[model samples]
Target: MSSLSEIITSSLQKYNDRPAIWVDDCVYTYGDLSYYINQIRNVLHQQLTSPALKGERICIWAYRSIDAYVGILSGVLSGMPYVPLNPRFPDERNLSIINRVRPKAIIVDKNCEDAASKILPTIKFPLLVFFPSYTQKPKWCSLIKQHQFFSQEELISYPLASISNLEVGSVVNTDSSDMLYILFTSGSTGEPKGVVVSHGNVFSYVNGINTISDCHYDDRYLQHIDLTFDLSAHDMYCSWCSGASLYVTPHNLILFPNRFISEYKINKCMLVPSTAGVIQGHNLLFPNSMPSLKYTFFCGEPLTGSVVNGWQKSAPSSIIYNVYGPTEATIAFTYYKCTGDSVDRCLPIGKPLINQQVIITSSSETAADEIGEILLGGSQVALGYWENEKMTDEKFYSHSGKRWYKTGDLGKLDPNSQDIIFLGRSDRQIKVRGFRVELGEIESVIRKIAKTYFVAVLGDSDSEYENVLGGEGYLNVVALVANSQESKENIIEECKKILPDYMVPSQVIFLKEFPRNSNDKIDYKEITKIYYKNKNSSSISAHNNVI
Candidate 1:
């Protein structure tokens, strides 16, 4: 029932000297966390409220520094939503979010100041740039004349004050409807859609996870996902709620998650199965390599039996669970704990969390089989797409007196086990390297760039280039364009400027004509077969073209 900020403050009071988070070589104690949070809170409250600026939320455009972590908390405590902007994302993509969110103040780390500079002029109103990690003003300060800037030293000199008006408890806002964060995911057309998650939604979701009964102060949790992704919430709250220490894996060690898990002796670890697939591709999933782990959870992508078995053996002492959920339903609301013996290629998603509900939309009550589009319901369901009434109304609807989100994923209930089994997306949406992406989004970009409507982008495993290209054993985004005059090289080159790295197509195949179905629509399955057949006959090494 408590907000994360309140839980964190309680931990600060109780476990003052205990390590709260390990960022690279630095271990930030709860005491250190308190000091930093105070400095940020003081500056934030002073600059935004004192000046009487009209702003909705705080935008955190930061790298994985201690400052970023403290900034997010300070914003939450102040009853303002925090929108995270990743430095890895393209300038165009990040700029779009900046233009849309129009946050009151932006918290930035030293590493992200340059990216911040590019978007400063875009802010239409008065804004504050709180540089917690910078001792001196950044070089880009002079370029942006409208906004006020504060260095780390400047904020430290401010008086100590509480943002929530509570000494050490999380009261985000008097209104339960106040938002905690707004996460943007891939859109069906082209742009990314913001998913507004309220403080109540996050708090309720965290409370629902209490039945797991494994997280504790002594256990060390490893953060393997990016802050931009919702999965990061699980890594943060699950540990903080239990007074457990969270170890933030450095970017250099992110790709080598298995090694990071082993080196740090991470007891509880959660990651996308794609990460495990990468580790397995490098032949690093050796038996007993991670015996210190007590739990291993995978989400964001389908968890295959091979990855499940490989991880179980690697972390012999750990219990592995395959988690499934769209970002709209908090981090995840359903999970299937793995048994050592699993023959199914793709593991079942299992059952709902303590407070969550899952239903097969297309199945009737008296049906012989329970199989259809899976819908998720409970406190975990997100508010809706931010300011997107049309989409919200379309996807979120009242069912049996409770709000439920249309997952778009097809699933079936296992009659014997009564667990939900994933049967892939009913639509063209797919996860590429742990990133939820829309095929039409990529196609839309290509259509606009190439000036043609005959563009089809899909994630295919048998792209006939896996053996040739150094793929990390996951679905690759491939584009099939029909007789477009624009060169494949040029179209993808332009797409890189607008789309994020993950959304960009890795390979482009030009077709003489797209095979049409009965309705003359682009035959996706036929086009894929044609692509594989063409690639097989050519025997061309796709290394030069694979992005």
Candidate 2:
């Protein structure tokens, strides 16, 4: 068993001159990466003297560039847990995260200096900030220089200090059970929670995937997901461990899917369902556009059958895989191969990966025969939420030497095929006229009938219903969002083909785009708020008519 540090060191030795990471036209070979990491390590050693600083929290605010990768690896090599902030994040959001983590230092790219400076004025913590630039020193750079806040050029040009050499120990010390990284959840609902993943947790999950997938040295992987998101974990570590070339597609190119894939010769890629929806909505195909792609992985949100059908039609030869997992369980715990027939049916999340065990537990915490919460027990389970003891105790529990994490998702074991069928969220289940309903079920049915890019179902509160039993009754409300401008009557008529009368949404709202979080997942809470706000202003009534 080797640590992450050992894996990187060995890869550099084996593929010294090989292209290790490609960002735009700038290529960083193994040798170049090794030297840069070493330089960064030396700078860290000079700045941090306290023991806590050895693995203290470090924040990085930068775009997808070579410096971003180097900054991350430098923190790992220096034994510090690092957090990455998307450069596009608003200043307030960025500051909120910074205050929560209270990092010892921050690494900023030159392009983001303006935002960084705005934050620095209000921040009291002593920060060591480094920026990458090729031009002459700017005014802010001179100001910081005068104040001795430290600059990148000074660190890079300074003589290397001679100190006791720190062996490239595991990037994470397994014995310590310490956190290796803190990835914050996309705050779509409210405040984002920081998930603390241990070194052992990451190792077990990555190792399992590496063995099953046979990810090898000859493979060239295209990294499309944001580093802030979990899907990038599979792309980063799997490629790093296998000594494969990692080509990072620029943010601009990612929007133009066909050209991005063809130009990079992307053989393997992972994307969110929203991205797949975009491709399908545009009526794009691979052979005519992105012929180089051989395999693609889709997850993050539910992949509709319609989306899968379009993908298969476009690249029939490409292996389409659907992976599912929460951040609490490393990157992914289950994967399914999507075939033609499988796409027509509800896409099963498939079985658990090697060494991971999953079971459907009822509300009473007893093993159930059918629908229940998805409970996972395996080496891949993370340590717990960071600085959140109450949540840690609730989510993580030990039973007979094994620990299980409650996934908070509803799923059922199929009686015939014995596969797991994902139902909607248990907490999201609502009661309409004493009938239980899952919003996901209604949303899934609506997707098949409409040529929509996205859809979300929420309980409505506008329609009034009279109680026949007691001369008074409570009214049930329902609302939905469709990514098209089709008439409300047309949509309700189409929805009738798949959904039952009670399950069909009472009102349909059309939007050109759905509000999304940083991870590209829909902001359901926000959508519901908007839905109710509109319902309060309109005099909508529920009648026997479809409209």
Candidate 3:
């Protein structure tokens, strides 16, 4: 059996009667969860005739409910890899994914029939849509007469005793290097890429976290991340493996985090930087709230200096950690505890996690203090991007008998503390005239001077440049999005004092809020789309000449 299933099965034996899941007002014990999982496993076995179904991929479409958790566990016990599709995805994208993965079957909630029916015509495989007895039936289900759908009561009536008799091994064997899940990344440029994570990779990460955080069976995890994102894996598997209780918050209560955390009694939680920013923004609302919150981790985007300061001020007693990793690295490979001193500047992403190694590599060999691309070599690195060998080969490479995933992020090692200080992305570094410029650096300076809520620096590539350069035609552009009333004049004045002529932003556009992607990160592609659309229509031109 794979380590994942073994861990869960062992936990169930120890904590059989303990409350395993709490969603809304419903509570499910470990015994109940185990029974439901076995029942669903029996249903899958009865429905499929092929002996090779053990390794086949299955797709699950459901909301954040106890039934969804049972469905995931059933997939694991039945030796099948599972993929979770968010209910919020549009019909076109959902259909595209179904066509791409070609899963043998799809398990969906009956409440989503209206949205599901829009994409049902595109799905060619068999399906088992589920309807819980607790919720009201959707009106659209009455129209679908051809497809097979099951209700909670009817499904439970099937003999689960037969399922208990069948021998079920783990979905992931030790030697089998197959993908356990395919999480689709938010596609800003075009179609999203499916990040394939193997069982070994996930196990390595979970084990590391367990050791570092001292996670135990008594830990009560508050799940805030969506199941589609990799961060959710920490809450799902970590809690399940340790025999801990998991509380899934309703989607509506997510934005108003104070209420969600208080009502759910969330002791431990993970959040994106954007959500953290909002929570910290309203610090006065919950001055004494988060007493039960023992561990809080933030990722999914860079945590700015201002945001960190706010969190520290609000949740003074909680242990705040800043974790860094891409989706390709199984959520996080390195983490930094936000000490009182780390807030003075940008917090350093501390040393690598267990079984992980990070190296700063430049064009030429250099000392430890040199700045370069942060290359990650570890057990947590994913297999590769699914089905795109050319793009996969470019990013994933072998070095020194170890496979390294080249993180496009730039960083420099601190000489005194030996921690990694994050710089901006290498691709984001632009050359204006003859001077090299880092947009993040400029944004940092502007943030300090303007004291804005958020800031984003965008390069305008299509600007006209005729006589700005000395006989050379260099385009003039600008930075956009700063949040403050004094931002326009304050940013210009600050830049003139500290920055050279070429480094100063040619234009600064203030806005109420910046556009963000589904993952809660800044949507640069959408910003570019808006920039071009507005540039063509506007007549007022502001260009800084660099000699």
Candidate 4:
């Protein structure tokens, strides 16, 4: 198969009539999936007449719904890259991404139709709204009079009624290197950058080692992450490649995933470390709680030893893996399976997956374990950031005749076992709820809003000298400002309007002046101590602050 669509199409022959996706207690079969994809392609053909639509981009705004998957896969199958926009995002963030991508089309589910309508004036192109057949007319339908609408019943029965094996191969022609999807992540420059991943990039991930070795056709996979996150690619594609049924968790059930796993009998699971952290917080670590699970993979953030041990006891049958990679690499490219023994409190991110390479540079051969910036080179590496050649050239470089992604992550090699032990980042970037966040970006927003020369945002990590930095809540965005007369509530509210919820600071600390080190730089450590000193009497209430 040249593209992911071909691989999915080939599975239809063998997994026909088998449950391919389970959403909201409803099972959709492989045959139904094929039918929907073909119908979507046909709808595109009828609606989009321009030949330029071949490699155009379509923005999909929705949560986890069956139609959402259809919209994404349909765009890929039709040779267009899909840009997934979370409808829950703040209007400013959404508008920023929309302006950057400049997509040719927009697709929205009922849940996000209203949000889509809000941005319609900003978007001059055509919009396609998809709603379930049984759904009532949306309250915003009359208000959104400027877009095209498709009900599940209207298009499900028309156009290509059946997708034959031959038709599948001919429906859409796409090259292996063609752009598949553009995922916009927080950038250091204050604007989100779209990471352009090709069809081959994700194909290598689904077909590569560790992933294929751990999953099988009969395994039921869980989809818990939002589609906007590239981690969702691993959940959706890996499950589809194995011809396994993908059980999607509703947003409301996100906090209680153990129930979703139990109800769906999910056997193969992929999770971000924060989600695992949340699971640990809930104390649902009873033995056999995840009895059906065979494999559990963690990525997108550091996996602590405590969480691994707790999960191991709960899912005794499952093999827990600590995988690592940046979005620049397709989903992930490294894997480390957890054993009881470890040199530190955190698990080491083991070795590279098949067809991938990792090296720690700027160290001596004797001190092979010396910590340095980690570099990844392999087929799994992405083409580059979309339309930002300057930034792409800076990150993606050629070395030793191979393309390499300069992973800004600092790590070292364990000389004894050759496992890659991840230290903290070399820069100010941090992962919050599995999303890559640039502290500088938040500081940039705060600086613009507060009109201050001194602004610092620190993540919670014990290694940092700041006492305020020692807990999971440290990942909560906090802004420390100097010479800002704006009320904390007022500053946070302004940030909430301009930034996404994830980027918005959970708390703002107003300081008369910042403490400085002997070198004259702002001393964050001392400021952390000062905050705690005043925390008892002057800090804002937790309930009054936005989390």
Clashing pairs in 1: 6-170
TM-score of model 1 (CA atoms): 0.93
lDDT of 1 by residue, 287-372 (tens): 89997898888888887777777778898898888888888989988988897776637888899988789999877757736679
- Across 1-547, the per-residue lDDT of candidate 3 in tens digits comes to 3477677777766788998888767888888887777666666677764345666667777778776787777766566777787666555556767777777656666445566767765455666555544243355556666455666665677665453344333232333255667877633223556777877787888888876786877777888777777888888888988889898878787666656666666777887665655455444335546566677787655555556656555556668777877777888888887753443345677778888988888623357777899989978888887777776798898878767898787888887787787775666544333223456666666777777746666554333322111111123436665456665766786666655454567777765567789999877777666666666666323212110
Task: Identify the runs in model 2 with alpha carbons over 4 angstroms from their true place.
Answer: 50-52, 133-138, 141-150, 163-176, 187-189, 288-291, 363-369, 428-547
Q: Over the stretch 261-358, how does candidate 2's per-residue lDDT look in tens digits? A: 67777666777655655555555644345555567777665555666666666656567777777888888887777874443434677778888888
lDDT of 2 at 205: 78
| Highest lDDT against the true fold, candidate | 1
Candidate 3 collision pairs? none
Candidate 4, 390-476: lDDT as tens digits? 999999987776679998989999888999988878877888767788888888888888888688876542223122121222346
Ordered by lDDT, highest first, the candidates read 1, 4, 3, 2
Give the winner by lDDT: 3 or 4: 4
Residue pairs whose backbone atoms clash in candidate 2: 460-477, 460-478, 467-473
Instruction: Name the weakest run of 10 consecutive residues (lDDT summed) in model 1.
Output: 464-473
TM-score of 2: 0.75
The 10-residue segment of model 3 with minimum total lDDT is 465-474
The candidate that wins on TM-score is: 1
Give the C-alpha miss distance for residue 512 in model 3, angstroms: 23
> lDDT at 263 for candidate 2?
74
lDDT of 2 at 542: 29
lDDT (C-alpha) at residue 319 in model 1: 85
Those runs of model 3 whose alpha carbons end farther than 4 Å from true positions after fitting are 49-51, 132-147, 159-176, 187-189, 363-365, 428-547
lDDT (Cα, 0-100) at 9 in candidate 1? 67
TM-score of each: 0.93, 0.75, 0.75, 0.90
